[model samples]
Target: MRHEELFYLLALQKVEGVGDIVAKKLISHCGTAENVFQTKAAQLKMIDGIGSMVLRNLKDKLVFEKAEAELRFIEKNNINWTYFGDEKYPERLKHCIDGPVLLFASGNINLNKKRIISIVGTRQITSHGTEFCKNLIAELAPLDPIIVSGFAYGVDIVAHQAALEHNLQTIGIVAHGLNQIYPKIHKRYVSKIEENGGFMTEFWSSSNPEKENFVKRNRIVAGISEATIVIESADKGGSLITANMANDYNRDVFAVPGRITDKFSQGCNNLIKTQKANLLTSAADVVYILNWNFETKAKPIQKQLFISLNNNEQKIYDYLQKTGKQLLDIIALECDFPIYKISSTLLDMELKGVIRPLPGKLFEAI
Candidate 1:
């Protein structure tokens, strides 16, 4: 939240060759961006991912002007910005390694809620896909989970609008930053989302939507939810990418099986056949897997786990909430704590009824 910290984050994001892994290494070793700015080449070289290219870029400092410009633009547009550690950052998105370091928001959707599901599928959807998305989302409406989707044509748009029609909070994760809405036609719904919930993105306002950005963005959609549903996708559709990312994150991935011969159904069928996804005939399948009604059966202590946390504990707790499932290694890397320290701290926190450990050495906030 400090100006200097913002400067470092912006600078790090703008660095030409510094990806998430590299940024993690640099942030871990340097302590903070302010520290990184004062770091020497020899010290920066000690971090594994930083190479001569990164060293040169950091030394030259290309991110300052760009960051400042973005700040100014955000101010002008009256958009909300949330950094990773901010209280307002989406709880389900905070823990993923590829989670956006920063977010530009313009919607009414609450990213942190008891239930959120991302609905994704091919841009070219079929009549069946449209009906499937609409009816499924309508069924989900009574449960009131936050519905997320990229506002592309076909199923994506249908999913968001369906949630809106049902008076549920829905978020559209844009491929580009807040500079402009792709397809332009959905501009009408932008204010609708903001008035009801909101949209979010990782890229700076000025950065144009690139092909690769969509891939990077999908992880956010996948990472921030209890589950991901593929309404309809061809074998190569972007929705499949989000579903796969959900699997890697250990979140539920569901597919609505369609006619075996339909091209749009091929990806969903393959996912179900290969066991990459669970076959979901209806919204009830997802609610069952997530144990949505389990809270009603939970003891008082379990309910307390979600609400009662001291400030420091809440930072770690909220991080796990936004990001979902993460191994101690990744959590340590992102939180900038040594693995042993994080493990010990998490153990203590777990014993205190603040978090839950999942299989595969991952942790989640209650």
Candidate 2:
């Protein structure tokens, strides 16, 4: 968004009664954030849900000072942001009524045309939960899904680490500003994630990671993805909150089954028993239920939009698409397919209209 517009947007956010929903409504009717302030109070009051209290708040001079401070901080820190109406904003999140009006970030986050899912659970993740998460991401790696988390302890860290291990993009939805990292110890992982993905938040530089902020930000974790998975959680936890928000948004939610006696497993068991989430076993569960059929014929869009490839073909395709051209041996090693199996798989993929073999044992996605 442009500077003057962003300044008015920041100012609008500071208005006591003007929240994301109200701000968006006002901006939609007024055409721009500046217009909201410039429009006559009599005319603004005529808009639906525009009450006298909000009109009074909009005239507060204190909001402009706050907006100016935030704008200065944004300029000095070189923070990148996306407006709700901008194409750069997350597509799935835009569907959410309570989605942030403005999102600020640090790092190289690419949400365009990518599969995104949020994995959340207790801060105290167990060994079994950790192993299941690692295996799940490894199997799903071929699909090139963007893994998202809250960037807290336990399951969140494990999911981020597993994504990095597979060279998959991972995003950390932080509760506080990008000025500092929360839980401080997790600082070590920040640079690595920002290299491939990045951290995103709606909070301004003045905000901190307080309990209330986290509760409010939970919606971002719940609404920003295609699905939300609970790896492990106690009967009562933040992950459960995220799952509930996901359900409210009508997004699919998945929970792993575990021993009933385990404290962490209780949450997952309750979620399944209550029919709040689907029973998740393996990565195939996601594929089957989400209807990710790779063998299905593609629709004609000149370039054959949304080509569905099997896991092996997807792995090979992702590898070749990322690296341009690669030797068969490299593709096999990189995708973890055996040498004998890769050649046959590549041949099958070629016939299925996904990839092509280059000269000198090289391969590339078609």
Candidate 3:
């Protein structure tokens, strides 16, 4: 969209009592939001359902100064802004009924990548939950996908961190504006994201991280992705909301099965049992279901000591090979090994020419 149109849309979004549908109607009638301001009050009456109150609200709230201020902030932060008509806008979300009129972006990856998956789960997670997130993300990384998630704690952070670990670009859909990151604790990872990936939101830069914004942001996460994965969620978890939104959008929904006794797994298990979500036992389950061609890109299996290990060692080796460079922390999590034993075993394997260690604590299979 043109800069003027974007300016209008941002203004329209902030207009009191003017919602998406109303803003859309106003745009349709006025030719442009700027035109809406130029048109006479009587001209606005020609459009159906646009009553006096809506008109008064539009006149009162359509502040160009506010929009210009937001644009200035966008410039100051070096953030990119996309209007609904921009090619860079998420194509999947463009068709949604309540899609945002303006989006704030800070990343290099295309939101419209060949494959996008939104990973969401409980903010409070168990070790099992975090492990599942790391393994699943690592498995999917080699397939060349753009990972999407809210920048919330727990699974969201795990998903983003894991994607970056594999050198894959990831996008975090924030509930608030670009001026600040929610929880503040994610600033470190969020900073990394701006470098390697991006952050996106419908709200303007000054918007606070309101509770409703998160529920609203889930739709964007759901709409933009080819699929949604719920790593671990309780009965009332917000991740379930994203899964449901994906289902509503006709995007694939996958749930990792968990023990019935665990509270966090209840949401996922319910989705699987009810057939609302496809059951996923491993990363291969997703790859096969989606038919992604990681195997075609697969490295040839070497018969050397590094490649000659049995199934378990080969599993670790495969991860190391695919990652090319990885931290011991990541390897232990991917292989689900005991942390205490992973370092000793990795060192022994390194000495035996099974793998090579690299600077900054990265490792690679020999």
Candidate 4:
């Protein structure tokens, strides 16, 4: 965005009671942030949720001074930013009511038409969690997904490192501003991360890594991605908060299951038990649940010529071939097979290269 528009936006954010939702309301009503400030008080009052306090706060000259200072900082540091309405903004986050109106970013981050997933867990990651997290990223590396995390110690840093090992893009959604790193020790990894992916935050250059800032940071991590995966967590933690935010955004959530007695597994177990998240066994679960086309360049195989199909498989195959593409439930109902039986049969057929799964739970004969 241009300097004047961004300046008005930063000032608008400083206005008391004008959060993301309210700012969006005002922006939508007035056409732009600059317009919001220029709009008449009578006109602004007509907007829903726009009270007198907000109007009075909009006139605060101090907000303009702060905005100017931040704008100067942005210009001096060569920082990158995106407005909520910008085409370059995270697409999924645009749908979120509470998504940040202005996001500051650094690095070679590219999210366009890419599969993005956020992996969040407890800071005290276990051995099992580390192995699973690394393996999951490796397995998913073929699809070239962008890995997102908080850039904290345990799972977050591990996920970022694993992504780097595979030469994949990894984004670190930070709690504080881009001006400083929270955990001073993590400074070493900053250059490497920015080389492939980068860091993103809604906080300003003047902002510090305050306690409440982390909770606000969680929403961005949850909203920006297509899904959120919990590698490991205790009974309660920030990862769970991120998972809940993802769920609220209608994004798919996955949790790595573990033994009932494991301390770190308790949170994941609870998420699965309550049906809040899918029980993630392997990367296949993510591919299947998200309906990702992992094998985009996979060559077609004439399975019927070489592979033998069982009676159930043949029946489903014939049905799919006749219908072209069909839903899993429709295939079960049409082939007179129970839902449970059909799912396994379909998986067998998929492995045999006789059928292919499409997005939205659809299947077609290959």
> What TM-score do all the candidates reach, one by one?
0.77, 0.81, 0.78, 0.84
Candidate 4 residue runs with Cα over 4 Å from true position = 296-366
lDDT of 1 by residue, 1-366 (tens): 565566678777887887765676677687776677689999888877678988888766447888788767777888777766678887877677767777778856565567888999988888888888898876566567888888888888999889889887888888898878887988888877778777888878766778988888899889878899998988777898899999998889999898888899999999999999999876657755675542222233455455565655677877888999888798888877776557546754654455677777788876
Q: What's the true lDDT of residue 122 in model 3?
A: 92
lDDT score at residue 300, model 1, on the 0-100 scale: 34
All candidates: CA RMSD in angstroms?
A: 14.2, 9.7, 9.9, 4.8
Per-residue error for 289 in candidate 3, Å, reads 2.6
Question: TM-score order of candidates, best first?
Answer: 4, 2, 3, 1
What's the distance in Å from true for residue 233, model 4?
0.8
lDDT of 3 by residue, 21-106 (tens): 67777877887878877788898888877888877877765377798888778778788887666688889887777777677788
Instruction: Give lDDT tens digits, candidate 2, residues 1-366.
Output: 489988999999999988999999999999999999999999998889999999999989999999999999999999999989999999888999999999999999999845789999999999999999999887677667899999999999999999999888999999999899998999999999999999999999999999988888889999999999999999998999999999999999999999989999999999999999999887767754575433323332223442566667777877887998899999899889898667657765654556656778787776
- lDDT values for all models: 0.78, 0.88, 0.79, 0.90
Residue pairs in clash, model 4: none
Please tell me which model should have the higher TM-score, number 1 or number 2: 2
Per-residue lDDT of model 4, residues 1-366, tens digit only = 598999999999998888999999999999999999999999999999999999999899999999999999999998999989899999999999999999999999999855999999999998889999999987787678999999998999999999999898999999988999979999999999999999999999988989899999999999999999999999999999999999999999999999999999999999999999999987878876886664533345565464477777888888888999999999999999999767656765665567878877889998
Error in Å for residue 222 of model 2: 1.2
Cα deviation of 121, candidate 4, in Å = 0.3
Backbone clashes in model 3, listed as residue pairs: none
